[model samples]
Target: MNTFRQHSKTRSRAVLVAGGAGFLGSTLCERLIADGERVICLDNMQTGTTGNLAALAREPRFSLVEQDVCDPVPRSLEVDAVFNLACAASPPRYQADPVHTMMTCVMGTHHLLDHCAAHGARFVQASTSEVYGDPREHPQREDYWGHVNPIGPRACYDEGKRAAETLCFDYRRGKGGGGAVDVRVARIFNTYGPRMRPDDGRIVSNLICQALADQPLTIYGTGEQTRSFCYVDDMIEGLVRLMRVDPAPDGPVNLGNPGEFTILELAEMVLDLVETTSRVAHEPLPTDDPQRRRPDVSRAETHLGWRPTTPLSAGLPPTIDWFAGLVQHRRADRRAPVAEASALHGVA
Candidate 1:
C-alpha cells in the first residue's frame, strides 16, 4: 500500500466527495472549491441529480465521477481526504430499494475505507440519527446504544449504518491487519436548507412545498413528536470541522442543533412564512419513527467548538423561497406544452 502523499505547499489538496450530486454533497463540493481545494465528486445519481451541481459546472477545480460506492473505486484518482455521503438518505428513496441501501451503507463503506487505507487519506462517514431509532433517552448522546429495530422496514438504513460505523472503527483499530485508516463518524440530526428536493418526503420539504402550493401539510402522528433542525450550512461546517480537527475524536460526535420543536410548531412556522391557505392534515406515523429526537451536542461543542448559529426563523424563509421558485418553475413547464399545441392549431 502506498503511503499517503503530502501535497506540496504550492499545490491545492484534492478531496473526493462521494455522492457529490446530492443536495448536501453538491453543497460540500462548492464549499471545497471556494476554499481553494480541488474537488472530485463521485455519485451514482440514484437519489442525486445533476441540477444540484449547477453552480459548480464551470469550476475548473471541480470534477464529477458518476459511479456507485459499492463498486471498486478507481485507484488512479488521488485524494487527500474522502467524505462518504453516498447513501439514499430520505425514507421514500432509501426504502424504494432497500437492498441497495443496505449495500451502500455497509459494502459501500468497506470499499471507501479500503481506498482510504491504500491512499493514506482521512475518511469521514456521514452517519445519521436514525442509528438511535425510537430512543428511550431524551437527547441522544454518542455513547447511548441506540434502540433500533433490526428487522423492521427501516432496518435496511438504520442497521446498515450501525454496521458501517462498526466497520469504520474496526478499520481505525487496524483490526484486520490493513493499516489503520483515519476515520471520523458524525451522527447527523435533522438538517434542512435550500437545495433540498421538494418531493424528498422530509418534514421540512413536505411542509414548505405543501404550503407553497396551497395544499394541506401532512403532519405525521399527533404532531407532538419533536425533532431538532440544523440548517445545511451549519451542518456542513460541523462536518468540515470534524475532518480538520487536530486529534480525531475518540468517538462519534452528534452534529445537530439542540433547539427542539414539535411537528405542529414547524408546520405553523412554515405556514407563517408562506403566504398560502394551506392547513395541517394529520397522517399516521411510520413504524420505527422516533417520538423525540434532539442531539446532545456537548461533545461537538467541547471538541470542535461548533454549534449551529442559524435559527429556524432565519433558515426557513430562504428554504420556503427556494421551494416556491421550484413550484413555479414546474407549473410553467406544465403550461409550455399546452401553449405550443394551441399555437400549432392556430397555424393549421
Candidate 2:
C-alpha cells in the first residue's frame, strides 16, 4: 500500500479539481479558494470557457492546468483531495463526440483514481442523476438499478457515468492489500445558474435564451417529462459536504433538490419570469430522453446533513439575469464584424 498523508482536521488542504473551468467546476474552485485552500484546476476546455475562470485567474491561491483528464495527470503536485468533474455533461455537447465522452467518464476517472490512490488523497466523483435513466421509480433512491438504453443516443453520458460509479467503488474496494483509495460519488441531478453556456442545450438555458430573444420556446414531446432543478450554490454545497465526510459513504449518494417540475411548466415559468412574447413550439423528443428525474437525497440529508435551501423562484431570477447578459454580449459580438465591414466600405 502507498504510504500517504492523512487529512488534518485543522488545516485547509491542497485540492485538485479536474473540470475547474466549467460552470459547476469553476464555482467549486471559487468556493474552495474562498475558504483559503490551495487549488489546482485542470481542464481541457472542450466545453469549458476561460471566461468562467476570470475571477479565479486573479486569485493567487488558484492555478489552472489546461489538460484532458483522459491523459495521465501530473504526479508531482501533492494534494489532500481530488475532485473528478471533468466530463462533458451537456447532452448535445457529449452526443457530438460520444466516444470521447465515454473515454472521459471511464478512462479519465481511472487515471484520477490511480492518482488519488497513489497519494492516499480523497477522491470525489461527480456522477450524474442520469444513472437513474428513465427511472422506474418515481423519486429515485441510491439503490435503484436504472433502466438505461445502452445503445441509445443518451447512453454515452448515462452509461459512461454508471461505469464511472462502478470504477469508483472498485477503487475504494482495492485489488489486494485492503482498500487504499477513499472515494465519494455524488449523483448530481439537474443544476442551473450563472456561467452556464447559453447554447448548452439544457432546458433551463434553452428556454431562458429563447425567451430573451423572443424566439418560440421549443417543446420536445408533450412537454410533460419532469426534472428536479437544484441551484448551483446548493449543488456546490452538497458536493463540498460529501467530500468532507469523516468516513465517506461506500456507494454513490444522490445530491440535488427534490422539487420536481415538468418541462411545460418550466417553460411557462421562464416566459413569465422574462416577460417575453415567445410562444411554445413543438418538436420531436430526442431518443432515450428520460421521462422523469428527481433525486431522493435522503442519504445526503442523513449523512451530510445537507439539503438545498434555495427554491426555484429564488434561483430563477439570478439565472435569468445571467443569461440576459450573455444574450446581449452575443448580440454585440455578432454585430461587431458587420459594423467593421461597413466602416471599411464607407472609407473606400
Candidate 1 collision pairs: none
Residue range with the least summed lDDT across 10 consecutive positions in model 2 = 339-348
Task: Give the TM-score of each candidate.
Answer: 0.93, 0.92
> Of the candidates shown, which would achieve the greatest TM-score relative to the real structure?
1
Residue 17 Cα positional deviation in candidate 2, in Å, after optimal superposition: 0.4
- Predicted candidate 1, C-alpha RMSD: 6.8
Residue 325 in model 2: shift from native, Å?
0.9
Cα-based lDDT at residue 331, candidate 2: 39
Model 2 agreement with the true structure over 1-348: per-residue lDDT tens digits:
332235566756789999988889989989998877878888888877666766655566777787899998878867778999998888999999999999999999998888887777888999999998899998999999999999998899999999998888888888513356888999999999988888788999999999998999999999999999999999999999998887788678999999999999999899889978899999999988889999998899889999999999899999999988877666322212433322211100
Q: Per-residue lDDT of 1-348 in model 1, one digit per residue for the tens?
A: 322246778878889899988879988988888888888888888877667776666567877787899998898887789999999899998999999999999999999998888788888999999999999998999999999999999999999999999999999998735699888999999999988887788999989988988999999999999999999999999999998886889989999999999999999999888899999999999998899999999999999999999999999998888888888777322212433322211100
Candidate 2 lDDT: 0.85
- Provide the lowest-lDDT 10-residue window in model 1: 339-348
